[model samples]
Target: MFEKILIANRGEIACRIIRTAKQLGIATVAVYSDADANSQHVKQADEAIYIGESPASQSYLQMDRIIQAALDTGAQAIHPGYGFLSENDQFALACEKNNIVFIGPPVAAILAMGLKATSKALMEKAGVPLTPGYHGTNQDADFLKQQADGIGYPVLIKASAGGGGKGMRLVERGADFLGALSSCKNEAKSSFGNDEVLVERYVMNPRHIEVQVFGDSHGNYVHLFERDCSVQRRHQKVLEEAPAPQMAEAKLEVMRQAAIDAARAVNYVGAGTVEFIVEQDGTSYFMEMNTRLQVEHPVTEMITGQDLVEWQLRVAFGEPLPKLQHELHIHGHAIEARVYAEEPEKGYLPAIGKISYLHYPEQNQNVRVDSGIVDGDEITTYYDPMIAKLIVWGKNREAALVQMHHALGHFHVEGLGNNIAFLDRIIRCDSFKHARLDTNLIQREDEFLFKNIQKANAQLIISAAFTALLSLFKQNITANNPVWQAESLWRLNISNSYPIKFKLDDENILVNFSPVEHGFIAEYQGQNYQVSGTLIDQNSIHIEIDGKKDKLAFSQNETALTLFSNAQNFKFAYIRPDFNTDDSDSNDHNLKAPMPGVITKVLVSANDHVKKDDVLLTLEAMKIEYSIRAPQDGIIAAAYFQVGDQVKAGDELVEFQVLAEDVA
Candidate 1:
């Protein structure tokens, strides 16, 4: 085994690899960018090296700097965890030339499967099942439109070198093909530097099931079963699980054998995944192969009792396969939810800030969390927005689902918006519980699934009110004196009726509180309640209200106060009584950057009259393009930013002239 291995990545996957390497008595080296200087992964590694600046192109994607760091540290092998240079063929070849082992598949296999169109053609030739579409090298707009016409409407135009849904577009009609194709090509060129694309039939209600395959240099290989990655938004997976629920035994065997065959056909080595799109009828088609450890690999690890990182290390050392095809066994069901720093209600835009407060639930036999962030870490805009991954395991699928729901509720993160509430809603959906999932699940049921979770539970409101009252009393006691007696104040205001109204969601609640033993007694709608608890800190209170015990944590800063309970975080504040109290001069009619990004194009010019929804400009961030639209029907009074300018979130890009009719 190698004495030291360099991890050429950051975030949760970097931390995950270091953990297994430590368990195996191996020292680990971590590489980080400027943004990740104080990251959790950097602190956990035995040795750390500074790579480059915050931008990935300057840091994580710099192959030479990474290889030099490995050489400087005397690392025998380099492990590319998931993204960045993980699947770069040239990086693997560079390691081979430098006599440093790459803990992944060989360069040839990576090159073979890296291009989507090329891989699809290769699979077809090798007798692997493929979707019926155009994989030819035709790039002309008219030619592609003809192909789409032949394939029928609702076709998918995918980048030949794309992954993670970048450079992809779905066209519902032939008339819209040209514009969508142009958008896809532009995105592909910017994201992957490859503009080649392929058109295919968009499979409706198709479940994304991928089989994990591992191989050795000696041409030995085996499959580690499958993971269902159907819960997605914008073609990116948000949740995943191993041993797909409601999957027939016979179909599973077929997928397993096909995955093994796909690996053998390419002479694949190290850890790789063969992805497939399975329809409702149980028929599956080959998608593409990922020639590196996946972001969702933990689900497979939990179900199979195998450390994929360990396997990568062993395979790089030229070891033979540890087990044969028949030796592998799936023991239990496991699910993983990717917690991202994005707001689902706000179109999942990336959120960035310092993590003021972070609380992770305790790990047990069934629940596991993999994260590379902490309370004080800064979530910058330079990298992927995934904050952490929550994984849970159980003896059965239903049990695993239940445990996953509970785990998501316990995860508390503040100072930035997240998709925790969105994840909780997904797991509780009837269609999801019945395993009726598909790639379009998020788009199909987004309105119902992404609704505000804080407003759903009535019990939570009472709990928050009780906890809030306790906090007020605790603050009074603490402010008065350190050793002040609560008994003396208990008798003074026992019957002083004071009405306090609070808003939970859309509803308002009126309650009366009076001093009581230990805490306060709350009365609402003729219900007598004894709420008692000592405040732990500014953020949390332990109390029993109306014979129901609850632990509530409240975080109040200048802007908002979020209450954590029932495994979900709820934001509450004193709703200002007056609506027009703020300074009117601060209400500027200007278009601002939603997030830090490079302006790709400016669709409007100064003095141009525009209507609401008119495109003003487009910005690219983290490989996703977002168009900034006009807020109202107005003239573009001034354009502050131009194409190719880098702008930060809230930085003004354009000024809109308010019309007299609109001023009212």
Candidate 2:
């Protein structure tokens, strides 16, 4: 094996590679952009090198820079961890030219399967079952539309060179074909620098299944069984599991053979995934091939008891297959949940902010966490917002899900939009627990998930009160004040009530309280309550209200506090008595940016009248497009920004003027 290998990616995957490399007694080097200077991956690697700017094009995708860095650091090989330059055929060829081993498939394999159209044709020729679609090279819009028309409505417009659902659209009618095509093309061009698309018949109620295949230079090949990635949102997987539930052994064998054939067809080596779209009836059709390690590979690892990264390195070094196809067998069931820093209530708009507190479930033999972040890390708009991946294992699917639900309860985050609560709900939902999964899991379970942000429940309100009182008590102790030492201060009277107002979402709660024997007597929402608290830390506390105890988490700013408990996050602002006396209405006409992002398009300009629900602007953050619409019919007084402008959260994008007659 080579002495040193440089990782050509950043974030969790890079860190993941580094971990395996270290166990193999191999030295690893990490390359980072300015944004990831202090990243956990950088700290974990044996040595680190500075790359280019934050944007991938200038840094992670800068093939020349990455190659030169590897060479300059005396590294013998480069591992392209999944995303950046992993599937770039040119990069593989470049590595071959430089005499540095590329720990991935060959250039020929990448080229053969790089584009969807070419890959589809090759798969068809290779006798792999394929979906009915148009994978032609004809780029004319009319020609594609005609193909879509012939294929029937509800066809899928997929970017020829897309993954992670970046450039995909489902058109349900001929009237929406052109618009869908336009949107798909734009997103494709922006994401992959390829606007070409393929039209295919959309599979209704489909489950995504992918087989893990590996190969060596000696022409030996084996399969690591399969993973079902059916639970998805926006065509991207949210959770994945190994040895798909309800999948028969006979069908799995057939798919495994087909996957091996697909790999042998391309002469693929190292780690790769052969994806299939399986109908409800168990008929599977080839979707596409991913030529590198998958994000959900941990589920396969936990079930198969195999280290895929180690396999990749061994094969890259010309080693034979570690185990024959017959020798590999699935063990316990495993599931992986991708925890992202994106909001669910706000249409999953990517949230960019400092992660004030970050903690994952405690790791054990059954539960594992693979992450690239720590507390105080910032979730910026320059990169994907995935915080970590939670993987759990059990003897059966039901037990695995039970473990997953328990693990999610321990997963915590603050000061950003996250999907932890959503994950929790999915794991515990009756449908999900029964394994009724598909690509529409989010849509099907939307009712029970993300229930209108979080209202100020009694638990949260009491937790907040405890936290505030604790601070005051600590301050008095530090100052040697005797006020808190007196039991009379515990009982609030006409002269002792200290009114504190807090804003929760759009509603406000006022509480007046004083110290009491064994607890505190607090009045909130026109009721008095007994509350007790134990300080866990400056940022965490255990509180009890009326005999109900809750271990809650909280963080505070100058005028606000964010409290998290029981899978819910409540934002509260400390309404100071001196700050603002204005009970006037807020500026509802101004459409503010929900998060920090660049304005991709400004649909309306100054004085443009817009109807309610009209698309006024669009924001692109964390590689997702969010449309900002007008809440009600209004006249635009002025446009605050134009296309390609960068804005922060709460920055108004448009100012509206309401005429008296129209308002009346």
Candidate 3:
């Protein structure tokens, strides 16, 4: 084994590799960007090195700096975990030239399958099932449009060099192909610095299934079953699981063999994944191969009872395959849900902020959480916004699905919006449970997944009220005098009751509280309930509401109060009745950046007329582009931001002037 290994990535994957390296008695070195100075991955490594600025291009993507760090730390091998340079063939070759072992595939294998169009052609020649479309080298726009026309409408234009849905666009008709193709090329150029693209038929209701394949330098290979990654949004996976549900044995073996063949075709070494698009009729087509450790590899680990990182390390050390194909067997079913710092209601735009309080569920044999985040960590806009992955195992698929829902429900995060509730709802939905999954599951089950979770749950609704009151009481408390803490907040001597205004989302709630001998009485919406509570622990509150005992997990910050209970998380914000927010606001015609990001495009200049929903400017953050649009028909009065300008959330981007008649 190597004496030291440098992790060429950050976040949970880096932490995961560090754990395995420590067990193997190998020292681990972590390379971090400026934004990750105090990150959890940095703290976990045996040694840490600063690379460059926060943006990946200046830091993580600096191949030379990363290589130098490995050499400086005496790291014999560098593990590129999943993203960033994990699949960059140049980085792999650079490592080889530097005489530092790259814990990944050989350069030949990477080159063979690096670009989508080239790989698709290779697969087609190798007789690997491929989607019927254009995967040619011609980059001419008109030529690509003609190809799309031949492939029929609903064609997908995708970046030929990168994955994760970057530079991908779906065109519904020939007339819209040019616009979609242009946007896709721009995104591809911005994201991967490559404008080349490929066209494919957009198969509706397709499920994404990938087989895990590993190879050795000695030409040995095996397939470790498969994972279903169909539940997605914006063409990115939200949840994944091993032993794809509803998969038949014959079809599994066929796909497994195809994956092994794909690896063999590239002379692939170490761990890799061969993805496919599965149709409803049991047919599958080759997608692409990921050349490094995957984000959802834990589910495979949970089911196979093996550490994939250990395998990666052993393989990179020139060791033979850990076990032959016949020696491995699936022990149980496993599922993983990716929790991200995003708001699903807001088009799943990434939410960036300091994490006030973070807690995953109590982990055990059946439940596991892999995260490189702590309570005070920051989710900056410099990189991917994934917070953590929740993995669960069970004896069967049904049981695993149940465990996933339970795990996601217990996962709590605050100070930034997250998709925990959205994930929980997804796993619990009837279609998901019945195994009716596809890439469109989120869309098909939108009504149920996005429904108000607190509407029918009286306990959760009341808990939100209790949380708001207790938060206010605690803020008034101090170490100066313990008695003044509760007394100053309640004012029981002078006033028995007071109206406290609060808000949940857009609803304004008026909660009336009055002091009682043993506890307090609170009323809302013409309903009264007796409430008494004392914090049992830092995150749990022991409360008796109307003589009913309940314990709720709680946390608070300056602006919002949160409570987790009954498999639900409720956040309530205190509203000040004295402040008239509408009176102080300026005209509503102005455009604002929805979140902090760097401006990438300015579609309109001052005095330019635009219709409602016209894209005025584009902002890029968290590796995704957000379009700021005109709220109403208006003329641009002033453009405050230009391309490449860094903007904070809600920062003014373009001020507009709307005529009263036009606005009406």
Superposition TM-score, candidate 2 onto the true structure: 0.92
Q: How many backbone clashes does candidate 3 have?
A: 0
TM-score of each candidate? 0.93, 0.92, 0.94
lDDT of 3 at 79: 96
Cα-based lDDT for every prediction:
0.84, 0.86, 0.86
lDDT of predicted model 3: 0.86
The residue-by-residue lDDT of candidate 1 on 1-664, one tens digit each, is 8999999999899999999999999999999988888887899999999999999999999999999999999999999999889989999999999999999988889998999988888888888889889998878889999999999989999999999988999999888999999999988998898999999998988999999999999989899999999988998999999988888889887888888888888899999999998988788999899999899998998988888888888888999977786787898899999998888888889888887888886798799999998887878778888889999999999999889888887788998888887888888887788888898887777667765445535455555665555455454333243213532333443555445566556556767766544455667777767655557777677667667777676676644457876556776655557677678666468878888888999988889999888899998876678999987888998888888999999998888887768877
TM-score of 1: 0.93
What is candidate 3's lDDT per residue for 554-628, written digit by digit as tens?
A: 787666678776456677777755665576578676678788999999999988988889999999988888888
Candidate 2 CA-lDDT value: 0.86
Screening candidate 3 with a backbone cut-off below 3 angstroms (N, C-alpha, C), the clashing residue pairs are none
RMSD per prediction, one decimal?
A: 3.2, 3.3, 3.1
